[model samples]
Target chain A: MIRDTIRPGTILRVLVLVALIAFLVAPERFAGLLAPLTTNNAPPIYNQGSLVDLTLSHLFTVAISTLAAAVVAVSLAVFVTRPAGREFLALSRAVVNIGQTFPPVAVLALSVPAMGFGEAPTRMALFLYGLLPIFENTLVGLSTLPPAVVEAASAMGMTGRQRLLKVELPLAMPLILEGLRLSAVIGLATATIGSTVAAKGLGEVIIAGLLSNNLAFIVQGGVITGVLAVLISDGFQAVARQAAKKSGTRPQTET
Target chain B: MTMLADAGPDEPAASWRIDRLGVVIALLLVVALALPFATFRATRIASGTGLLLHEALPAPAAAAAAAALVAALAGAVTLRRPALRLAAGVLALVALALGVGAAAAFLTPADNPYARIAPGSGFWVGVFAAAMLVTDAMVRLRLGPAGRLIALAMTAALIAALLASGAWSRLSLLAEYRSRADVFWREANTHVILAAGSLAAAVAVGLPLGILAHRVRRLRDPMINVLNVIQTIPSMALFGILIAPLGWIAANVPGAHALGIRGIGMAPAFLALFLYSLLPMVANTIVGLNGVSRAVVDAARGMGLTGLQRLFQVEMPLALPVILTGIRIVLVQNIGLATVAALIGGGGFGVFLFQGLGQTATDLILLGALPPVALAFAAAVVLDAVIEISGRGKP
Candidate 1:
């Protein structure tokens, strides 16, 4: 269905998200993934081993937050995207959009009071704000099931849940997975916002270095986080593609 | 038509429960309004004044509670008829006016009722009154799903109004909320313009990038990836990064003074907010473009359409939903990120937030945060309406 999404699109996407996540989970992996002979000025500090510990925490937080986000998001998607639920669909999505659109930094900043300081509030903010993508995608994927396939499933005596689990979900898996992939990457990137709240993450390094004018620290931090996001995003995308391929489903949008 | 016969079974109990819940919520609100009126005590109203922050009830806050009771009952009773709803809403507002006049009837400085009614518990009671009144009117207007939704929506609005009005009193820093109705309108207007500008910039930047990536396969990944990175950087850090370079440019650039560059005005703030917004705009564009079906493209081409012609006519038109999707995303994000711009000499709504943070003033932060939020909701509704009107890519 992707009309103009550019070519080698997958690889750039892989690099984009993989690079970010690698910086977090396996900085060593990220360093090795780089093409080695880079001419870019900012490459060296990214390859260095200075930010391993900090990157780990950021990765861990994002991973947890993404998982937490998935439950709420998928449920919300189910609620809002149903035909009967359409009235509120736009509104719910809009709410999610607002949540995400607000700068993660703003969420953390606004949250300090009442919610008080620490990782708990940051996590709460991240979870609340980061639910849009997956929610939107999951709803789209589930709702747009081809009539023929759904009819066939019902004709074959499949139960409603079975049809959903077997036919619809599989068919929609690719796009849904893509949404998750992007959401995961976005979540990881925004996790840096948590640093402002004094939550432990690579953001702390980035924020501290930027404020303190410690270019080396900034370089190290940015590179590591960027690599981490890329790697994880790539992995999700690969899984998405595999899922799509397994389903042998035609893309929606036949003219 | 055949698929309709094979439609999946729904959870009867679940659907029933939701309907019940909606009605239940509406009833609870109605009950709350009426019940409180019975238990309500008619204590004497209070009067006092100092800073906006220092206003308190001259008499016990019980009187304010009594007013809340009256406002709620009045709201509940007046909302039965469409015409009456508006009239009652207006009448209660007038009663509120009289209450204020009575409270502050004497000398106006240390004895102003404006502070007492608008501050602390008075402000809270006022919120309850406003909520009851507005919710009552909304129910009569026949807005769907509002019974349950309005409760939450009204609460949020009330909280935000409380904070905004606090700032408007101008007794604080970061953002001085001017309490006069005219000043309030001005601040609200500023927020609207800020939101509009943000959406405009995002749409302008995103649409082209989406088209470019769609046309050039190799460009897609890199474009989307760049957006992803843009999204990841926290606004605070982004601002921190932007300040040094931007401030340097503003300070050194020749003829900058003629450009309305005040060393730290809107320039750096816009840049920071703009950078952070790249993710949704770019990502939505990529997603939408990718989603255009091959069959449609092939059909256009087979019909003898040139590459450019098909790209513009078939492809972009078909891709409008996805494009709108991006717009929606960018618009929402812009509203929120606009606030963060206030932190570093950037102007928008964040001044209230940071000021509140610094001074422990919830009201100030709320003021800065509210208008953008309200605007986002308004924009979302308008965009959806446009999307519906166009019938873009919908089955």
Candidate 2:
């Protein structure tokens, strides 16, 4: 279609593409995405290798943590969406809202006492915050299932669990995926807080730049973080769109 | 009016019930009159506030009179059928007002045993709480969208009032009261003003970009996808990244420093803040635009409106509520994240927020934190009220 080639959001696409291209070639303009491992005494927060590994592991943590949250959120949503479970739905929603409202930095500080200042606590915090979108969307998706299809399945002798797994879950998958996409995006952003609590991530590079007052290092960190955020969020959105197409549903990611 | 018009056109009913409201009003007035008499050291209060308002009277007598006034106002709390939850609210205001008029330190000597609840402090709380409740209620009852716009006007008024009335001089608890008021004001108000500015700048830049992309289908997804990605970057780390580059620009650029560009001040902190608000604004704008009906657009085009005209006349209006919602979200969020900008010395209300955390001075932090939280919530509610008033354009 004519709309496909010159979409309304064209400039945004070009700009983002350029940013991505420039970022991928970053190693060519520089040695790598990180500064050297050094021991200059100041606010020297993290070394170089940790920075590299931190970025990689942080992504993994986000992916896995979000995946875990997705499972819990979706199932909770399904269970709570049942006719007998309306109260649970309201309760879970309130819980999710409070979880998101409880600031991440506050969580980081508090988690230090129990989780001992590292990736574990940061992951826990991200997982907790990610629930808002996923849980909210799952309930929405499950509730929106077409009645005719559900009745037809039930009329054919599908058990309660059978109908949920076969018909309801499939019907709700697209909306559920949208929730996951939002969670994935939020989870990736929040991963930066890990640095303050001694959790490894791209934030280490940022913290490093701050301590040394090095402009290049700061750009390196910001560019990399931006690039990562863009890539992962886009990937999740793509999957969500694909799921929406398969299910033949409206595409919506905004909550 | 349809149910949506909100207020019951019952002003005559409201006025007629003033007699019913009289118990609260009278009680509050009496309490204000009597407080100086009951204050810990009546001798000092007689000289303190009685020197002015009731110069003819003694402190104990004044304090007793004020207490009596307050007890009467307290009766308003006894009313039922909270009626849009305003009855409980009005009673709260009257009690607070009378309490302040009676107990404020302005009317009692510093050493007065009962000076703990100074008349000055009480009056501020009483008046503010009363004003807030009544103002909010009136807005809902009568003004609608106009109410929200006026709320912002009111917040500005409150700020001015705080400054003019020298209320800033009295905004401290007993434990923290002796500290510098100017310092606290600077540390608090500056952050809020800066946060608002940053969010505004973000919306300014983001809206046009979003509109452009929304009109360009090919550009929309990729651009939004990138914005989506950029948004996922942690705010704290993003701040860390801007310091060096922005600091360099500040040091090197001519007159940049003169333009309020400190290494870690408004510019870089704003750059970080701006970037953070981008995704939501851009995405929401695009989504809102996309959500607009194609048939209506075609009709606008058919009705002889040019593309630009349609954008302004049709699309923009329809998309506005959604775009504003996005703006509201970003604005509220940036206010919170702006607190972190203090880490880089960007000098916003966050200065106190972060310090409160670092020093564990909940009092100091509360001084910083409560205002912005209150401001953001009020803004959100007012905006919702505005959307409610905007009426069927699609929020």
TM-scores for all candidates: the values are 0.61, 0.64
Return the lDDT, model 2, position B180: 43
- Residue B274 of model 1: what lDDT? 66
Q: Which stretches of candidate 2 lie over 4 Å from their true place?
A: A1-49, A56-68, A88-103, A106-124, A198-201, A245-255, B1-184, B291-310, B356-373, B393-395
DockQ of each: 0.14, 0.15
Candidate 1 per-residue C-alpha lDDT over B59-115 given as tens digits, one digit per residue, 9 for 90 to 100: 443366345445545444433443454454444444443343333322134633333
For this target, which candidate reaches the highest lDDT against the unseen true structure? 2
Interface RMSD of each: 8.9, 8.7
Q: Which ten contiguous residues of candidate 2 chain A have the minimum total lDDT? A: A37-46
What's the TM-score of candidate 1 when only chain A is evaluated?
0.74
Q: Where does the lowest 10-residue lDDT sum fall in candidate 1 chain B?
A: B36-45
Q: Mind giving the per-residue lDDT tens digits that candidate 2 earns over A61-93?
A: 788889888888887898777754542343354
